[model samples]
Target: MVQLGSRAGAPGRHVVLCAEQISKSFAGVRALHNVDFDLRHGEVHALMGENGAGKSTLMKILAGVHTSYDGSIQVEGQAASFSGVRDAEEAGIAIIHQELNLVPELSVAANIFLGREPLIGGVLIDRRSMIRAAERLLARLGVTIPPETRISGLRVGEQQLVEIAKALSLNARILIMDEPTSALSSSECDTLFKIVRQLASEGVAIIYTSHRIEEVLELADRVTVLRDGRRVVTAPIGELSRGAIISAMVGREITANESGKTAQDGAVVLSVRNLTLDTLGPHGWRRTLHGVSFELRRGEILGIGGLLGSGRTEILESIFGVSRGWRDGNIAIDGAPVDINSPADAYRLGVALVSEDRKERGLHLGASICDNVALPSIGVLSRFGLRSFASERALAADMVKRLSVRCSGIGQDVAALSGGNQQKVVIGKWLGTEPRILLLDEPTRGIDIGAKQEIYRLIFDLAAQGLGIIVVTSEMPELLLLSDRILVMCEGRQTGILARENATQEQVMRLAAPGMAAWSQVSAS
Candidate 1:
């Protein structure tokens, strides 16, 4: 049994909210058991757990999304029962979900004040007042997005900031943020941390949930870890180490191991020379990639590392024939030049891409696991121009078993699974195509530590089987861990490539930094 730490060093702050004996179930599945949690005024309490460990369920209950849960909630020493989100808002509570909940077609100001808009004469909406209020909230967060800009026009990090601004607009006493920084850059994360500190200082109690342990350690005053739907431990941040937190979250020690056999001398599988892509943005055709060149050897992992909008993802998109831009490059697969104009052409040439945004671009959320996994192989599985259910089921079952996807069999809807499992389903769908080269973009984003380790092992295993892989990731540790060689990018240009043994975080960052003349010369393997 792990000894829990006492909440010390803070004496005057009283409990602002509490949940006693909270338990929830969904479709005969026990999502959470009897769990006790509380938040103090001016505290950043972090909730940590693996995927499907009941963290989201608990947060939803507190946010009034799930009103059927068995629990007793107290707000400032008064028993409170919230029937809906409006009731929770009336109680001065607001929650930002892990998934962005804003409408894409709506403007930034419209999304910020979605349901509750300012009215002129208590009848018509005052667009000017709403925009002004939205601007103030964005200004408080140090964001400069225009109030009238459509949500679809913003990047993922910007969208996340908009979500934060939306939560702040409620002026709630209690705020819950679920995986808020999953899509943010380092600088964006720093800005968010400053805002979180400021909010806590203003006596706003916050319940923060994230899979990033370092962020939790830096920002959280106390941590409550849940495992298998039960509270594992609640301890002050000062009393716990990284190892302790991992152990509490996964019930074991996590060991770091090499991904797979280092195959530096292997045969070249794919080669790109002077790759350039130009996309038609709001400002007309803009160059996104310029003179990017690299070679991927069979059984080697090449990592693309850069800051946001640095053309890291664009490289993968171009190679996989999915870039919505004009491409100018020399691509050779197995020493033969090839032209890939569409995803089908890329697939025919033994190439597969797992997109960064799995929910939006990778998987069909409304479909079942079998349907999603079998989608990429429908042509192969069809007989006499008709779909074969037996073949699809067999393929789905095999992939599910190989990937260790936890679900109610392959018939379960993809939306019902946890983040880690949904990612597996996406990978499985691409693997069903039997591609020789795999391109992964931010594959472990929003997933827990345990799931990330599993993905790392899988990537290594695939590489060991002589499959070439190109991975684009924002995580420094993941880039260092999985890449045999790291390709650093800056402003759509290739900075340099560092060998695995020689690549350090500092070296990668130096090359990744824009306008760094010292390492501007690109190096190829």
Candidate 2:
């Protein structure tokens, strides 16, 4: 492991990687500007900022993903420029992007050595040796996954581990992990942290990017804040607090408005009984949701909280027709049973769902903002084999103004907006359909505080108009603030449900965990 001098003035040490005057642009937008960064050997440097803060752009330049960047890179005190990722890898640099890059049908070993495979007899590919090498790498990282298993057969966490192994196979001295824990379970994250510590101990310089503030403070040795394509601040982890870091990233004061929701007495509008989804386990084992049920009244907000695989998301999806199977469940809208066999069927039944994966499943990125907003209600705007563009624009314009969606115009592409505004577009599409019951899955994920406030205001407005809302969230504070009633799920079952006035963070977390003694009592009550 190479040693480096700390900011506190230490002895002779080597700076493994250095960047000076890094500038990058896409189209006409400057993604990064004069960014100077240096990584010492055996250090985990965290890049902190909100979405679209140029952190990823800067890292992409270092990984050679963006070859057009104007910058001088010095590795071992020698000026260098990489034309491609292969060039960077040859220079001992590798990056594991936030999005998984692997062929689902391919085996773990195949993915590890995809571009550079070992050859045998100067002709045939060595399959057995590749699997053996993959197994060895997995063993070194303290992760247990069969090398012969296809990536499609593995969980998201296991696939992420495969990516890490792929980088390690390059003998990369500098590793960049982008949002590594975004899709990991708590135990899987612990395993990843252990591996990260091991790599740091072996003098591997890591540049980590994550939105989770707590994890950054715990793992990163030094933190760098970027805002609006410029470097804002750099300091050791101990020198900055969470509040200070957030301020640096946004360059302004940010605050969350705690919802003071008053208790509501309203008639039931939507009811679900015995909803279930069949799920496959690690080794082709099947698990079923055992008789999940819930009810929401008009002018009321219901919150769902659970672990990642606890069937919370599945339940909402089932209600919205995202999951299609023989659902032996009773779904009632306004005291009338309805068969929601498809998304269109659910929409006709006055039920709208904002899916968790907004970018992929909900919004059409290439479509204009007006078109995306009118997608759910395009039928209403159509007339005699022709659609009213004026009406569509008017509807979308009103929604954009009402939701405070910051966009250039109604003609702007949905992809041009920020994460928060994109989310508003998702909600707008549903609201334009004019559903009586709304189902939201992580609506506020990856958004800023001002946008969050706008979303909360919209939810409250809909509820006040006698609409029923069901929100599924991983954030405890969001669950507490926005819910009139809370339902907690664990291990494919309902663990507890509480009235919002009586629910606390401590109480919610206790019930949300698997196999607690309060499960039966809380469920019964």
Candidate 3:
């Protein structure tokens, strides 16, 4: 439905962008190696690789997100040095990252034209001109959202489209889309694909990257697969098979059930009855959750599934004693009623939580892994009034080795680590507390496939060791693969809890949409 660009034919088929001898490293660990890439105008070239394959690193270098990498990029047959993101934009290059980048407090139009706003009389910002420009832009993108709508109010799919509109506004000849479909629904993805093809037809050279192999195969004119930071294969999409691309990704064949299933018949370890929460507004308070209840058993992986704003996160935060609106709830652990009013109470009761935002809530970015892993259990690791540095180091080293975190050393800062390794450090730090129950919220959200498998295996191992675990995820394949039982939530209420053997995507989706249907039923695993 979107009109991306002028329908004029390309001047001619030619290579518009090229990179030579691209290499990047973080703290002595090589992330890329001599990766040569070139993009032809009017082509959709997909960059494929497993997590840690340097696909993102390579794209970052091209987009001027990382200017320190060892590489030489040529734009339009001329050697160009991009000093920063603005430089790349000036050179007709724009990128839409996997994580939607929009200021939540600003209006949609303000975000679309963030830096280069039209000014009147060389003085005040032209708000009226900005809205007109934004309206025209959104209409071209086939989106109906108002120009004045706050970004925070828009859904994920809508935000993604706004990002696309922003890039299109730049009029970039070379556009890079990184994992653009990750947050989109099926219909949203179809819309995105249609726009991508339209743009390509108008002579826009596109660099498309995604973890979904089928998507790459369908949309990409050429495919380039990277492994261990090196280019393994680059060829026309017709010349590559799905299995071949996958095998090149990980150097092995992987099955749908990567970690396999657990017995899932252990004793009930956590029981919740009639939990409720309310958001305090200026006038008073507004209710969110309505008497939600469920049970989690040891040696079992329970999944929470729902659409955005379904209160799936509220369930985890409330259970971990971090929710401000835990109005009434009865939580019993090991057949005894427990009161967890704070995170300390949850920790003391052998419960651990890995929040959705690992960077903000889980890890201290400036601190070393050694300090981070020992943070929660400092009291247990200490002797007398003074904390023992030696014990902390030993514990940190043990956790590093146990989790197989890819880092230069345990003394390295967590902020420098990759997305996957940062998550591992978060998991290791939490596991150091030796929790009997673990609650993970969107654990693999921004991570790669390989890292996801590692997390899945770790969860299975923990469950096998009699640790009860609850995972909340929006990824349907992940929920189907890991959950021994699935609980669907809608508008902060329990819609249904389904046994693993009988649970299906259609049923879960139905329950996820509020008032879509009468909940089939709910039963404990």
Best by lDDT: 1
TM-score of 3: 0.85
Tens digit of per-residue lDDT, candidate 2, span 218-266: 8888898888889999888889998898889878777766554543677
RMSD of each: 3.8, 3.8, 4.0
Question: What is the lDDT ranking, best to worst?
Answer: 1, 3, 2
Highest TM-score among the candidates is held by which one?
1
| TM-scores for candidates 1 onward, in order | 0.94, 0.87, 0.85
Q: In candidate 1, list every pair of residues with a backbone clash.
A: none
Question: How high is the CA lDDT of each candidate model?
Answer: 0.90, 0.81, 0.84
lDDT score, residue 465, model 3?
A: 86
| Better-scoring candidate (TM-score), 1 or 2 | 1
Model 3 regions lying over 4 Å from their true place: 2-14, 23-31, 68-72, 98-109, 128-165, 181-198, 201-203, 255-264, 280-287, 324-326, 513-525
lDDT accuracy of residue 39 in candidate 1? 94
